[model samples]
Target: MDLLPLAVSSVIFLLVSVFLYSWKLNSSGTKLPPGPRGLPILGYLPFLDRNLHLQFTILARKYGPIYRLWLGSKLCIVVSSPSLIKQVVRDQDTVFANRDPTIAALLGTGGVDIITSPYGPYWSNLRKLFASEMLSHANLDASYVLRRNEVRRAIRNVQEKIGTGVDIGELIFVTELNVVMSLLWGGTFEGEKRDRIGAEFREKVSKFIELLEKPNLSDFFPVLARFDFQGIAKEMKDLLPSFDEILDYVINDRLKIMDSEQVEGELPSAKRGKDFVQILLDLKEQNVAEESMTLTQIKVLLVYSTTIT
Candidate 1:
């Protein structure tokens, strides 16, 4: 009788699995773009060449301009022709707005920021907020002095190293990072403290970007994402605390200053107007219905701003 019960249970499970699999095929009735067949699970990931541009060109010739490739569980539709690109990006934008973000990106930013969020009301709201607040003319105008000063500093550095063969690329990278940091938070950590913090940030940022670019099995086989079989997610988690430390110090320092400013009626932290960090902080304090951002969202925004690399 026990064996009979076990057999019945097995049959029921088999029936449910078959039903679900059939339903998946039925639901996705639309045909996918034809391309090379790949192995089960790994898909085309193993077959990808390091020289991916050349490989893609070869694939384009074989599969036509617009074709598909299965990267593990993920299906990628590549559009080579400009007309196809326009059709996908402009005409069919709504149909393809959602993105398949890597597990590292999710761990790094908590999947709430604009780039990681799904195509939904939350993403739409974030876009509207970014357009009206972050990319607004007033915000860019306010950041002009920060940009000019950083460029002038770079010029001075280059001038000092004239005929010494200064690496212009390195000079530009540091200058850009400084401008991003200043725009994110101006004069929060001045002089030695600022330089020290920037150096620490650069070290962490290097590892963070490295992990972001590194290929991981989890992103390919999402069923293994929870396992983090490749350790990409764990590395990202480890990097988070370091990022949090710097962010917490700067944010708390700013909060203290803002509190003092409130008491004394001063906004001297800003030269012309509030920078991006200040504006985000202001929004964080407000209780705007359905539009208010959370602390995680705010912190993620701040960290991502410095991810120029």
Candidate 2:
């Protein structure tokens, strides 16, 4: 007889039983928002339209302002009312502040970056660092010259290419790239090296965004994460090292310069132009302890700041 199919069926039956039993136990006396009953195991995922927002609106109209959806095993609560959003975001902000990050996002940030990081001391410290050090008025003023120079360069380049026509998107991207790199490292590449760096950065950022947006089975089924069904995790892991190497090169180059200056007895005050990395390294040297920035953290922040902008 076919014992294999029978064994699989038995396992599935037991899993469903356990799932329902636990669900019943937890939900016995609780009232959940109304939602469409979905098929076993898959939930409402397979039935969702490509226009998810439209679908959500339709569901909200039928189910009232707030509704619940079971996407695979994940339970999603949707609130469409402005008052409810205000209550969640402003009135009781701390209660709902933490995020349940997807597998891809978790992998991308390594569970350490500001965006996907859970609400805690670490996130608070990072927020303070960003506000007090990175995006402070003084720092913005200091970066004005760099920003002005890059903007002027972009304008001049576009002016030169006016008659032939230029890709506005590409122009803006290049200009932004130059400005961000200048702020981060205070150095610019030239000729082939510049072209190569630009291509590399663009490629990696594209891949990162693509991976982030792609629906992975691992995200839907946490137990199946190790299998990496869509290979998004693998692609992300591979993409990360290249980004690390580039950041490492910039950091090491600056460190070498700083070391040479130190050897010549140059004080920290004597350093010419200060970049974001240098400022972060100084903070690291101050032994911020639990709030201290690591090399990985620095690189991650750099990526976050540039790409997010």
Candidate 3:
């Protein structure tokens, strides 16, 4: 058994080495932008400095305004000059509209939310939805009380701390989470239930954020993605259930309330202004566009709207 395992490992290593050498030795006929020559297979990945910005700046001085860099098997184009950047971003926006979504980002948003969706008609629709529903002045003005209350609550907590040390990041996260919760759930939860939910949800969000930034080998080398050697995919999969639990609870609760009110002849206007969650729910029900959003998409949108804010 041990011998078989060793032989398999050696074969895998040999295959990878052969592929790398062939990839390195082969030259593309098409000319590419100027850049420093890098190592075989791995390219500049192994030679990367900790200060990426500074390293890229130095490379720009040597290579020119635009250059190509190979990180593992991935090819990256670095644009340094202001004029070139403007051309890429403004003049030729559609040419470079889409982004390569990371594993964590793809999982978290389900590629449905405005942030992760590919640049196309669906993405344009999401952007319009964001502007009209989420970022509208009316929506912001409506959420003012929630934001104010959260800020005041944060200040009071800080005041209580007095001279003791405080973690500004933690305080800010709590305040933001509270405001988001109020906006999403419409004050359905209060005091202990809210605190418990907040604490639990905070852990999940923090882990998800960290995972978003975590460097995974699979990202650099697509061939290794299926193996998930770093367990990044596993961690993200584990968190999804917890996300579903909270989302389902809140959504189901609100749905019940909406049904009750409809049966009782109570209009939506009679209640407090619809929250972000309610608005999204209503949008889906009304089939606001040619493509109706799924429940999962709504949940992802809710998460994106709350967290990105």
Candidate closest to the true structure, highest lDDT: 3
Off by over 4 Å in 1: 1-30, 268-273, 286-289
Candidate RMSDs in Å, in order, are: 5.6, 3.4, 3.8
- Top candidate (TM-score): 2
Native-to-model Cα distance after best TM-score fit, residue 165 in candidate 1, in Å: 2.6
Residue-wise C-alpha lDDT for candidate 3, range 1-309, written one tens digit per residue: 469999999899878976775555456414668776577567778888989999999999999988988887788899999999999899998888898888888877778878778899998888776678766788777666666767899999999999899999999876877887777765455688877876777688778888988888888898999999999999999999999999898788778888888999997524455577777787888888558878887787777766677
Model 3: residues with Cα > 4 Å off, grouped in runs: 1-26, 159-170, 263-274
Candidate 1's TM-score: 0.83
lDDT of 1 at 41: 49
By lDDT, the better pick of 1 and 3 is 3
lDDT of 3 at 152: 90
Among all windows of 10 consecutive residues in model 3, the one with the lowest summed lDDT is 21-30
lDDT of candidate model 1 versus the reference: 0.77
Give per-residue CA lDDT, model 1, range 203-271, as digits (tens): 887898899899998887778878887788888999999988987887888788789889999764465
**By TM-score, is 2 or 3 better?**
2
Which has the better TM-score: candidate 1, or candidate 2?
Answer: 2
